[model samples]
Target: MRIFVPGDAAAIALGADDVAQAIQNAAARRGLPVEIVRNGSRGMVWLEPLVEAETPAGRIAYGPVEPAAVSGLFEAGFFEGGAHPLRIGRPEDHPFLKRQTRLAFARCGITDPLSLDDYRAHGGLKGLERALAIGPAATVEEVVNSGLRGRGGAGFPTGIKWRTVAETKAQQKYIVCNADEGDSGTFADRMMMEGDPFCLIEGMAIAGIATGATKGYIYIRSEYPHAVAAMREAVRRARKAGFLGERLPGSTHSFDMEVRVGAGAYVCGEETALLDSLEGKRGQVRAKPPLPAHVGLFGKPTVINNVISLASVPFILAEGGAAYRDFGMGRSRGTMPIQLAGNIKHGGLFETAFGITLGELVDDIGGGTASGRPVKAVQVGGPLGAYFPRALFGTPFDYEAFAAADGLIGHGGIVVFDDTVNMLEQARFAFEFCAFESCGKCTPCRIGSKRGAETIDKIRGGIDPGANLALVQELCETMKFGSLCALGGFTPYPVLSAIRHFPEDFGTAAHLAAAE
Candidate 1:
């Protein structure tokens, strides 16, 4: 018998390791031979530590298991698929997993990430195979038809970006995967890299094929130790199997890929800053217009993309563009990997098509706040994303929808906050975070951010509260309009969202003192 459980960081934190050990011990006591594999999550994170016992029917699943239940699980012929409390019947039947529109995560929890054969069996390398079968132009056209967009914050069209890079004439073009995920609630990159590494590899390889880029690099952050390890091992496996290194699968195209680790720096998540970090320089933002697509990575044309964008390529290629196009609503085509975190009762990754309402996710899927109180506000995207109260819960999860709500779908990380939370403190923290993380390339972001925090303090102190509020808004606008990169421009989203949604929280302690 074979059993697989997630080895993702989130799964580990939730005691996946212990669950795996319990399965081993249970099998030992039952005298049933079992080989346990630590695969990645199926991305239905609510069912985490999700244990699967392979049977003739299918992989019988159980999850959120506690170690104490090992003996009972074994005694009940768990290996033979007996009724278990943790059983969700068919894992596919669950509403959270069933409703999700998985594209980038198509192969995530399903295949053994390290196994090239497993990857190939399940529509893996189909994109690259098809790309090599046809020409680069056809591949680019397919991507365009697929309507895939960057699953990163911007939601830029993937096909257009590839075409831009392909059109650029440069001797040294590069494919850079921006795995520098500094966002608090986002972990899709981390999970994808660790769980389904080959998807990213194949995605980058396809990007190389489409754009005529001979080299690829995944700029992973140091915080994801397990991902880094998994990627290194996957690279080794891919190279050994001829999926990477010089001539790929006997094609004329020759591409190479490597992983570079960045020290703890939030600014490097920016494309230019990432380029700077790659060059072993201090991470800082750069002026666009000679955008990275035109002049990037050591002064060469580069395709800088997020993990999910790159990971989604294989699906688009194997499944065809029009198929993916059918999944999304409006301009936002294809499935989105939405991440849930923070104060929600069920915090995990939820990949779905781009039309579900925030209220549906928070109230129905998330099961409300963990504290059992009414949710006051939810922060979609990252810390820099805006706060949307229950009033805006009906808003769709599309990029345009989020942008219209004065929020972003940044990495699709949604962090929930209950009524007990104070929005003012959260707003101030956003400003403070911006001040701390500003790359210092532009003045407004560097200096005005500090002023934003101090100005918030003044409002908190009740000294000229009305004037101070106005000044804070003014400062935020200046930072938003005048800042160099997203680090500064996005800071205002959180600050302004707080003031707009929860005006009472920013009230000074002095106001309370006076009232009492």
Candidate 2:
């Protein structure tokens, strides 16, 4: 009998380790021969420790399983696709899993992350093979035609960035995978890294090949130790397997990569700052004129892409760019691994086409708020993302659509909030977060965030409510335009959006005063 248990951090946090051990113990007690394979999460975090038992039909899912329930599961004939309360049948049949496109995440949770053979069996290295066959220039063209964009906040075209790097005349070009995923309620990067490390590896390898770069680096945040470990092992395995190192399989072009952990600075999530941190310098945003593509990582040409952006390349390459582009709505082509977090009941990673409405994501897919109350607001991006009220829930998940709604799809993290949430506090928290995480490189971000928090405090205290609110707005405008990096520039999104959408929570005095 084959039993699958998630080795994903979220699952482990929810006591998956204990559940795995319990399964082992229960199998021992029953004297049944069982093979326990620690696979990546299926992204159904709510049903974590989502144990899967392989039967004649397929992998039957039993979820949110506790250690104590192992005996009960065994007694109920779980190994043979049991009739237990925790049994969730086949995972792919679940409503949440059924709705997703699962292109990039197809192999995640279904295979042993460290097994190269498993990765190959699930259509892994096919992209690299295709890239090798088509050659670097064609590979670059494929990405360009895919209409892929940077999944890390900024919606810059991925193909354009790659084309820039590919066209650049450089002695030593580089590919940097920005895995420093510090966005609030965002774990898609971590999930991809931990679940399917090879996908990221394949993506980076393709990037290196396309851009004529011989070296690549995955700048993962220090917070994600599991991701770090998984990636390091995957790299080693890939290197040994000839997928990496001096030359990729069936190709003369050479590409190798290493995993580098960041110092846990949220500002480093910015590309320039990440490049700086990777260069052994303090994390600080660099002014854009000569962008990272031209001058980056030791002053050479570089292709800096988000985890999802690069990971999507494998699929784009394997199936052709047009195949990948056919999934989503206009401009925002291809699927996104949207993470549902905070007060949502069915919180997990939902990978789907870009045209899904905010209401469909929050109410229909997320199953509303976990508090059993009406959702008051949903923050679509990171902490710096806008606080969208129920009225704006009609907005589509597309980048341009969110931008039109005065929001962003930053890392595709949607944090839901119930009616009890105070928008004032949420707004204040955004300021506080920016203040704390600011790199202190620019005056607008370093000082404006602090002042913004104080001004919100003043409004909360009912002190010169009208003037203070106006001042706060003015400060936000300054930060929005003047800040060096997104750490400061995007900070205004939540504050201004909260004030615009939920004026009542900012204090009745401020609301009435603004009315006058």
Question: Can you write out model 2's per-residue Cα lDDT over 1-516, one digit (the tens) per residue?
Answer: 999999999999999999999989889988999999889999989999899999998999998898989999999998899799999999889999998999999999999999999999999999999999999899999999999999998989998999999899989999999999998889999999999999999999999999999999999999999999999999999999899998677779999999999987999999999999999999989999789999999999999999999999999999999999999998999999999999999999999999999999999998999989999999989898999988988899999999998899999999999999999998899889998999998998999999999999999898988889999999999999999988899999999999988889987765775576
Candidate 1 residue lDDT tens string, 1-516: 888878888788888999888888777876878888788887766667788777776777887766786677776667666788887656667777787777788778877878888888887888889988887999999999998888778888889988999999988899999999999889999989988999999999999999999999999999999899999999889988888888888688988899999999899998899999998899998899899899999989899999998998888888899888998788898888888888888777788888999998888988998889989999999978999989999999888988988999898999998888888788889988987888888998888888888988888777888778878888888889988888899999999998887777866543443355
Each candidate structure's count of clashing pairs: 2, 0
In model 1, what lDDT does residue 289 have? 82
Clash pairs for candidate 2: none
Task: Candidate 1: list runs displaced more than 4 Å.
Answer: 508-516
* All-Cα superposition RMSD per candidate: 2.7, 1.0
Error of 2 at 419 (Å): 1.3
- C-alpha lDDT (0 to 100) for residue 222 of candidate 2: 96
